[model samples]
Target: MGKITGFMEYERLQEASEEPQKRLKHYKEFTLHLNDADAKIQGARCMDCGIPFCNNGCPVNNIIPDWNDLVFHGDYQTALDTLHSTNNFPEFTGRICPAPCEAACTLGINEDPVGIKSIEHFIIDKGWENGWVKPQPAVVKTGKKVAVVGSGPAGMAAAQQLARVGHDVTVFEKNDRVGGLLRYGIPDFKMEKSHIDLRVKQMEAEGVTFRTGVFIGKDFPADIINWAKETISADQLNKDFDAVILTGGAEQPRDLPVPGRELKGVHYAMEFLPVQNKVNAGDKVKDQIMATGKHVIVIGGGDTGSDCVGTSNRHGAESVIQFELLPQPPEEENKPLVWPYWPTKLRTSSSHEEGCERDWAVATKRLEGKNGKVEKLIAARVEWKDGKMVEVPNSEFEMKADLVLLAMGFVSPVQSVLDAFGIEKDGRGNAKATTDGEGCYRTSVDKVFAAGDMRRGQSLVVWAIREGRQCAREVDAFLMGDSVLPR
Candidate 1:
């Protein structure tokens, strides 16, 4: 540690966000970063904790203390190198990751924790500015080829690792662009797509091939246009490539199976979001789902729901309302009981702060509509007893809603892709694969491996990167009989 008592001396400082009034007009990143001196001060706040639980708290197990110390000592290059050692895409995580590491920080017990995420963001951004990021082609080739399906964080991480380890890696994305969810599902206000573009360029330089708009399974009308109509059977991949890794994300959004779900203005959050991202990338869309001039109602209260609220507001919706089926969490968590772990507490997102009428423990009973389109929501307040919800007596209500977005989260990866390859699925409908023992991450069907949300179910981007990196190691070992790649 550069400064032994620095944690005691420094207070936690967060990066300021763009003002709500100013930032609401455009879908752009507005997080103000720290200056070099300020970043060093923040880095110095890292405590000399012996165990360093923040490393374990992070999904990728980043070398937090090492980088913090390096930053504190003004060793910019070393800080960037240490940060990159664990995370292949710190820039992405630095922006969108929930920063569980802060919750695990020793200083967080009684006071604010070290600004680790901001420091990481600063280090990596500095790395790019100084031209430290570059291609690292493998010195030797293993002559093994691998096909990684999905270009999200998981797939990208796996492809990069495989390419670095001398295996020929080709990433297949079904969209017009390379990045899977990162390019489409995520809003530009959180993380700009330029970050994904630079990484794609770097991966190309590192000998990884990218095939965009390439669907591996049976091509349906919904499938993006690319490559051959002949679906690459799992058996064919086994015969051609040495190994195949499926890192495709969970795409099956949970449907509100209730009546009136077929209303014209009702749509999945994914369907509404991707269009804006595409339009930002210069792809014109017809009849885009516009929240402008409409009373928007978003269902669900997680990150995706928050994103919908933000996007809807940006669309100039007249009013936005969000509903959560669960009871409202406590304003503050009981820290002593849940230290070093994520705790359930009330968290108001930047989007929530912009504008929204939020209600908890409220369930939508049925949607009432006119002219075959959603017009109003019939809902009721719920009371919880013994972990079960019961409607409150006479608490039924109706709210005007011209547009409704379902952000209830994903159920699983699209079954079509899995069915096309005849891969087995677990009880949760995710790819059947384990992360322990021999042939870890190898799907039931030989040579075919699975990672990220496809195997673990819908999860955070940080977790996706971890799974991808680990799966890459397993695939590498399986192909070469042994691997030098880190687990």
Candidate 2:
């Protein structure tokens, strides 16, 4: 530990954020990074716990304490190195990850946890400003070609690792740009697209080829959401590339199968989110879904729902209301019972802080509309008894809703790609692959592998990176009989 008694001396300090009113005017990152001194103090708060659960708590198993000590000692470059060792994109995780590491921090049992995410954001931003982040191209070529389908965090990480290890890696994306979800699904207000651009540039310099607007499947039907200019068959990819890794994320959104779900104003969160991101990137979106001056109802209380709330507020919605099917959790978690683990408690995101009427334990019965457009939502109070949810008697209610955004989360990956490749699917419809044992990440078909949401279902960016790195290692070993890449 850099400072033995620092945890006792310093209270947790978070990064400053812009006022909601001021920040709502533009689509840009509003949270300011912590200054060096404050970051050092926050880093110094890391106690010398016998076991660093924060490391395991992090999906990518980030080397937390080491970087904290480095930051405390003013070793910024070393801190960046340590931070990047396990996690390929600390900037992404620093910005969007919920920081399970902090929840499992030793000090968090009794006091505020060490501000690990803030310190990480500081280190990465400083690294970029100082020109510390650069291309790390391999000196020798392996002459083996690997195709990574999907250019999201997982695909990007796998391609980078494979390229760095002297293998030819080509990333295929169905969108107009390299970043799959990061470029479209995420709003610029949370994290500007420039971060993804910088990483794309770095990867390109590292000898990784990015083929955007290229769909990897047998057919590119007009019914699909792919904006690809060309289509490559799965058979052709298998023959051309020595190995193929499917890192495509789960895109099949869960739908609310209720009356009037086909109404004009009802749409999936994805349908609404991507348009705004495309508009932010200077692309013209036709008939884009907007919440302007409309009473918006966001169903499903999760990150996606919160994002809808923020976006709707930004669009000058008359009002925004979020609904949750489950009962409300306690504002504060029972720390004694869930210490060193992710606790079940109410989490208020910055979007919620912006302004939203949130309700829990409510189930939507149906949507009523006028002339095929949503006008009102019919809902009922639900009570959980003996692990079953039952509707309360005569508790039916209705609310005005000109727009409804379904944010209940993704159910599975787009099945067309999986079917085209003849890959086996799990019970959940995700690409079936084991994380351990022989032939790890290997799909039912030969020379085919799966990872990230494609294999494990919808998950965090950090987890996607982890799966990508491990899958890359598995692919490398499958090719060369050995790999130096970390798992």
Number of the top lDDT candidate: 2
TM-score of model 2 relative to the true fold? 0.99
Query: Whole-model lDDT, candidate 1?
Result: 0.90
Error of 1 at 386 (Å): 1.4
List, in order, the clash count of every candidate structure. 0, 0
Candidate 1 lDDT over 268-291, as tens digits, reads: 898889889988888888889899
- Candidate maximizing TM-score: 2
What shift in Å separates residue 370 of candidate 2 from its native position after superposition? 1.3
Report lDDT (Cα) of residue 367, candidate 1. Answer: 88
TM-score of each model, in listed order = 0.97, 0.99
Across 253-319, the per-residue lDDT of candidate 2 in tens digits comes to 8999999998999999988998899899899879999999999999999999999999999999999
Segments of candidate 2 deviating more than 4 angstroms: 218-224
Please identify model 1 stretches exceeding 4 Å from their true place: 219-231
